[model samples]
Target: MNRRIVLSGTGLVSAYGSGVAPYWDGLCSGRGALGPARRFADAPGYRGEPVGEVPEFDPRGEPRKSAYARAALAEAQRSARLPVLPPGALVILVGQAPAPEGGGQLDGEEWELFGPSAELRPDGAAVLHLSHACASAAFAVALARTALAAGAAPLVAVVGASVLNRYEYASMDVVRAVARTAARPFDVDRDGISLGEGGGAVILETADRARERGLRADLTVAGAACRVGGKLPAASDPGAVTDCLRTALAEAGADRLDHVHAHATGTAQGDTAELAAVTAIAAELDTPEVPVTSHKGAIGHLLHISAVPALAAAALSLRTRIVPPTPGLTTPEPADRVHHPRAETPYPGLRVAAVNSFGFGGNNATVVLRRD
Candidate 1:
C-alpha cells in the first residue's frame, strides 16, 4: 500500500507577528515583515536596514532560549498541542542547528556567515540539519515523507527556523539589486530578494493515522525531488532549475500544473533561471496558463524556513481557494509573463501547485502538492 503523505500542522514565527493569525493578518493588510537591521551589534559600513527579524521573546529566561530557533520550536509544539497528536512521535528534521549553540557576534560578515555554529546534541532527538540554504525546509518535508514510508518513524516533525544574522544582512545588497525590491514573478523590474528570519515546521504522519486522530487532512504531498546544483552554482541559472522542476513534476506524476509557487528571489539571475524553467515546461505543451507567485516579496527570504512560507502560501490556496496577489510587483517581468494567472484569492483555476527552492552547494528541491 502506498503511504499517504499530508501536511498535518504548521507553526511559523516571523516579524509580521509570532503566530499564524499575525502572519495572516499581515498578509491581508498588505504589510510585509521588513524593518531595520538588528542582527548584529555593529554592522560596519552596511546600511543593514529592514530585515524580517523574528521578535525577540524572553519571558525572564523561562523558555531558556532567545533566538529564532527556540521560538520556532515552542510555537510548533504549541500548535501541535492544540491539535490531535499521535504518541511516540519523533523529530526527524531540524531546519538548522540550535541557535543558542551557534549564536555569536554580528561582526565581520565572514566570521558571521562562515562562522562555525549550529551543532548536534546527544540528548536531542534524532536530528538532521537540513541546511541546503533556502531549500532547507523543502528538503526536510521531503525527508519526512520518506521516513514515514520507510517506517523509520511513525510520527515525524519537520521544523524549519531562520534568523537574519549580521552576515546575512551584508549579502542583501546583491539580493536587493536583483529583485528591484519588488518580487514580481513574471515582472520586468525584479531586483532581487529581501532577507528575513522566521520558523515554520510541520508535524506529519500517515493519512491513516491523521484520520484516526481527527486531524486536519487538508492536502497530500504528492511528489518531491532533490538535486545538487553544484553545476549551476548560482541561484539564478536556468539549466539546473528547469531540471529540478522537471524532476519534481515527474515524481509527482503530474504533466500539467495549475500554478507554481516560484522561488523567484527577484535576482536577475534567479529570475532568469526560474523563468527559463517555467518556459521550458510550458513549451512542452500547446500552451500553459499556470500563474506563478513568490512569498519572498512579502516575507523576505526565510532562509532555512523558506519552505514553511511556501507551505503556508500553498495551504492558504488550498484552504480558502483564493490565490493572493504578488505583492510589490509594479510591472510583471517579461520572463514571468507567460501564461501567468491574474486572479486573487479563490483563484478559480488552481489544482496542482509546485513549490521550488534552492540553496547553496547547488541544492535544489521541488515539491508537488494537491488538495487531499
Candidate 2:
C-alpha cells in the first residue's frame, strides 16, 4: 500500500548526547565529532583519527545496569510522551548481535558468536531483530509502517542502536582507507565514513490513533523504498540506488525534492556513486539545488543506527529551511555536496525532503519525509 499513515513522536541518543535536543542542535549546526580515537587501544592496524563518541553512559552506578537497547527504549518512551498509546505495539529491535560479532571473530567462533552480548529482558515483549547491514533502521521503519498499514498492529517501536564494538575500528578502517581527511560527499577528496555509536527510538502509529490520543508530530513518513544488490555478483550500484529513489518518490507523491540528507559516508566509491544517483534524480526536478550534507564528520557512521540521526536532521532542515554544512568541506563544487546551515532558514516553508542510506554489498533505502 502507498499510504501507511504516520502517527507521532520519536526519541534518540547518539554521539552528541543521550537526548534528542542536544543531538538535533548538533545535527543542524554542521558540528564535527571527530576526536582522538580511543575505543580500540589494544588493537593494531587501527590507526585512524577522530571518532564520534557518544557522551558517557554509566549504567552501573546510581540508576542501574542499562543495555544500549534498553536505554534507547527508555529514552524513546520518555521522549514520545505519548499517552494512551496502544499497549500491543510490536517492538522491532535492530543490531541485536553479540559484542564479539563486531570485534572480528575469534578462532573457531561461529555466527552465534557475533550476536548481541546483552542478556535479554525477562519481561521483553514480542521483539523482532533486523540484521540488515547499514539499512537496518530504515528496514525496521518500513516493516513497522507496513505492520501498521496492514492492521497487524496499532503501533510499532522501531529501535536501532549498537554498543561500542572492537569491529568499529575494523569498519572504520574500511571507511578510513577510502576517506581520511573528512566526510566530504561529492567532493573530489571524498574518502569514506567515520564509525560512530548511536541509539534511536521511534514510535509509529496510525493518524486516526494519533488524533484520538492527541499526539503531535513535526513530520510524516510519506513513503520509503529499498533496493538490494549485494556486491558479490555483478554488483549493480546505479541500478539499485535509482530504483529505490524512483519507487520511494512515486509512493510519496513527490516528484521533486527540496532537500536531500544523504548517506554520504565520505567513501570515494560510495559518495561518487551516490552523487551519480542524486544528480540523476535531481535532473528530473526543476530545483536541482537541494543542498546535501553527510553528517559523518559530526558523528561517524552508526551502521544500523545511521538513518535516525540523519532523518532527524532532515526534519529540522525542512522545519527551519536551512541545509546544514558539510563540516570538513571548504570547497563546495559539483562533486562536493557538503554545505552550511544559514542562520535563518531561507525557505521557511520547504515541505518534502529525501534521506538516503545504502549499506555494504548493496542495500539501498530512501525515505521521503514531509513536514506535517
Which candidate leads the pack in lDDT?
2
Q: Per-residue lDDT of 307-327 in model 1, one digit per residue for the tens?
A: 777777777676666666665
Worst 10 residues of 1 by lDDT: 114-123
Cα-based lDDT at residue 202, candidate 1: 69
Q: Can you give the lDDT of residue 260 in candidate 1? A: 76
Per-residue lDDT of candidate 2, residues 14-112 (tens digit): 778777778767766667766655644455545555566666766453111124455666666665565433556677767635344234644322321
TM-score (all chains, Cα) for each model: 0.83, 0.84
Most accurate candidate by TM-score: 2
TM-score (C-alpha, index-matched) for candidate 1? 0.83
Which ranges in model 1 have alpha carbons more than 4 Å from their true place?
38-41, 55-67, 74-88, 92-125, 171-186, 285-287, 336-343
TM-score of 2: 0.84
